[model samples]
Every structure is written in C-alpha cells, then in structure tokens.
Target: MSIRSYLLFSIYRFEYWMQKINKKGAAYMLALQDVTKKYGNQVALDEVNINIKEGEIVGLVGPNGSGKTTLMKILNGLIVNYEGEVVRNESIGALIESPKYFEHKSGLYNLKYFNDLFGTKQDVGKLLEQLNMDHYKKKSVKKYSMGMKQRLGIALALTAQPEYLILDEPTNGMDPSGVREVLRYLRRIAERNNIGMLISSHILSDIESLCDKVYLIHNGKIKKEHRPLVGFAVEDKDIGKIEHILLDMQDASITDNGIVKVPKSESKKVSQLFDEHGIEIKQIEEKSVSLEEMYFDMVEEDYK
Candidate 1:
C-alpha cells in the first residue's frame, strides 16, 4: 500500500485499541459523584451519582420538581455552587434550554456567527444538511417553526465537534411527529459521531427507545438506575400458578400485561416447571421491559 494508505490504516488501528481500552477500563466521559444542590433551605439534588461512558447515550428522567433540571445544570456548569465532584471531558456541548439566536438573522447566518465566536472551522452547510435543515438554511429565524429551531439549537451545540452533549427537554413543545424527528436526529448523531450524550426528557417513550441506560431521580436523589431490560416472556392461562412457582426466584415478576418475565438464565427451569405442573403455555418469546413501566414502578415505590 501507499504511504498515505498505510498511515491511515495505522491511525484506524490505534483508535480501535483506544476504544477497546476505554470500554474495558470504565473510562467515563462524564461523571458526577455525590452531587448535591440546594435552594435556600430546600435540597434540589442530594447525593446524586451518574456516569456516562464514551459513546454511550444516557437518559435523565424524573417528575416535575424532582431535581432533574438541577442535576443537568450542575453537569453543564450552569450551577457550580453545588456539593460533590463533577468530572467531565474538556470538550463539551450543551443545549440546556431554548437556544438564543438573532431573531431576524438567517439560520445559516446564526450558525456562522457562533462558529466564528467559538473559533471553530466546522462546515456550515454540512451541519445544516445533517440536521435536515439545508433547505431553510437561508431563511430568517423568525419564520422558523419551533421544531426547526430545536434542530438548529442542536446544530449549534455541535459546532465545536465536542465529545459529549448535554440536552434538556429537547422535545418539549413539539408535536408527536416533531418529537420523533428530533429523536431520530439525536440517535443518528450519537451513533455516527460516537459521542456521549446525557438527555433529559419528560417523554418516556423517547427515552425507552433511545437510551442505553436511564437514571431516575426523585425528591433530590438518584433513586434508581435502570438498563434496557432483557428477559424471556411466557404467557399462560394459569398465570396464578406460574406466579406461585416463580415467587421464590429472583428477577421474576408478572407484568400488568399478564406476562411472566423470567431471567434468560432461568428459562429452562421455568419451562420445566410449566411442563411438570401441566400449565398450558400459550406463547413464549424474548422481550424487553418498557421504560415507562419501570419508571412508574420506581416512582411508586419511592412514594411508599
């Protein structure tokens, strides 16, 4: 191979090795340990710990007044007077809330302005194209819809090609279609660029579909950490009998949909139990637990 090709190949191999080491070593791009924030006498965040590994997409979810916003602010350095250590990658991008732009300027012009301010050499046209906003690149921001604005906000955050992104309620005020569009763009950006993202949203469905892990906060505390569930699903008419059999097994529960969730490791035992008890199995399949159900379950338990 030519010298140029050999150099490129060498670089690729080096990058692959670095990524492998990062994964095995738990090299987090951002981490917040025992973070706490207060407002007057009220605690907004208490002993919250979170970590985002390189190229991972993490979700922050909680009810209103549940300190989700406060935690996000701390991550972005918007609130620095809080307790705890926040370690983050030096190169970071964020869209905490609504992005500010010249109302009368074109979208492309606004992006160019920020690019200049940040001394970044990012290609304006390519950024707009990636966000599906190339057609309206020259249109005045005043005429852009809310969804369009949100897309532009994301483009602005990406101007510096940062390694990590922090977004708060990116789909707020958007219609269903708009929400889906934004989510699709975000997922594509994260995977294609191999960037870590911490996204906070009230939309549980979006979180369920996109996030690799989720942090549920309640009453100023990191109440629970949930991963995308993986298990076996068994449906039987004798649901009550099956429940009794699996009662002593850990990680076994019957969902409200009347499906018994058994750990994949215990699938054979579950099958044998059903056969020995003569319980009729209507269907069996592999399934994942919905984030909405998990969120509600966590919140309910906290209340109790």
Candidate 2:
C-alpha cells in the first residue's frame, strides 16, 4: 500500500479501538458522576449522575433554565469550572446552542472547514445530503434561515465522526417535518455508527420517541430516572379525590384531562383506593405514559 493509504488505514483502526474500549479496556461509555456546577451563588447542576454506552441514545429532558444546557456544555468540554467527574472514553462531537460560521461562506465551505480542521476526511457533500441540506449547500449562512442553520450545525458536528455526540436542542428552530426528519436521521446514524448520544431537549415527545433512557431534570437537579406510567381516565369530579388518594405515590398525578396517571406497579393500590373511597368504577385502561405527565408528577412531588 502507498504510504498515505497505510497511514489512513492505521488511523481508522485506532479510532475503532478507541470507540470500543475505555481506559480499563471495558465497554466504552461517557459518564457524569456527582457532577455539580454553580454560578456564583446559583446552582446550575446539583449532583447529577448519568451514563451512556455506545449505540445507546440517552436524553436529558427539562424545561428552560433547568440545567440541560449546563450538563451538555460540561460534557462537550465547553465549560470547565464545574465540580464533579466527567468520564469519557471515546472521541466526542458536539452541537451546542447555535451554529456559528463565516457569514460570507457557503454551507459547504463551512462544513469543509471543520472536516479539514478535524482531519476526519468526511465527504462534505455526502454529509450535507445525509442532513437533507444538500440543496442549501451553496447558500451563504448569512442568508440561511434558522432551520437551515440548525441542519448545518448538525452536519458540522458529524464532521469528525466522533464516537460520542452531545447535542443540545438539535431540533431547535425546525418546522414539524424537519424535527421528525432530523430525529429519524439521528436515530439511524447513531445505530449504524454505534455512536453514543447524549441529547438535551425540552421537547418531551421528541425525547420519548428517540431515546432508550431518559433523565428528567428540574431546578438544577435530576428528579427521576424514567419509568413508564399507566394512565387511567376517570370522571372530572373524581380527579381531585383520586389525586389526594395517590398523594403518597410519588409518580402519580391527575393530568389536565382528568386522567389519573400512576406507575404500572401501583395499579392495584389505585384500584383499592377508588374502591375504598366509594368512587364509581370506570374501567382502567393501561396505556403508555407521556413524558409530560411524568414530569408534572415528579415536579409536583418535589414541591410537596
């Protein structure tokens, strides 16, 4: 083989090895343990713990100002003055906040810029195509809309082909269709490349549809690890009574539509409570829990 070809081959082998092992030669993973961050007197993240292994899609779900960005920034090595441990065993690529580029440069130009900088030898044109941004490749970023720029940001993040990806609100500014497309593409690439992803988004539906595990954060703290709840619809009049009865259940809440949601394991308790309360029987149908419902329950429980 030519000298250049041999060098390229060796690099690929090294990257693959890195992707598969940590310093201990164990399965690769990115982790945050007892991670805490504070800005002056205000805490940004409080004792956060999370882990992601190759080919796994883990999500950080929280509302605005809930430390999702703070966590992602720390993982991406953008913020350094935090207290805690961040364990990373593979190369990382990140798309955080906004995508910045030379205003006068075309999307293709900006992508190529990063590709060369990382020495990843990515085909810029193909990357654009994968992101559905090929049609806009020749347009200067200065003229690009928010959605287009978002796509370009993701494309740039993939330039290095890093084994771990930290994406913050990757679908921000996209239309509904664009959001679906990006989520699908991200899932495909993550699985195909066995890339571990740590994604932060306030969009619970998006997180629910894409992630294998989810960490719900609120008030700069992780409130709960995700567990599916079964929702039970009841009369509006009984909503208050049902909620009161389930008060002891940290994961139970009466949603806005008069549906009482509780952990699947607590279905018996819920049924017994209604029976003892002399509440009329409506068949309880088991259904998948909405992230929003679970978030509401956890946040309310936290306040109590």
How big is the RMSD of model 2? Answer: 10.7
What CA root-mean-square deviation does each model show from the true structure? 11.1, 10.7
TM-score of each: 0.72, 0.72
In the range 1-304, model 2's lDDT, one tens digit per residue, is 6534654664565554344333554443798778899999999999998888898788888778889898887776666677777778778888888756777989999988778867889998998998898789998999998888888988888899899998888898899999999999999988789898988887888887787668999989988877555667654465556767777887687767677877654676777888787776565765676778888897788679
Model 1 vs truth, CA RMSD: 11.1
Error of 1 at 144 (Å): 2.1
TM-score of 1: 0.72
Which tens-of-lDDT digit does each residue in 269-296 have in candidate 1? 7778878877666677757667788789
How does model 2 score by TM-score? 0.72
**Best-fitting candidate, scored by lDDT:** 2
Clashing pairs in 1: none
lDDT of 1: 0.78
lDDT of 1 at 23: 25
For candidate 2, give the lDDT of residue 206: 88
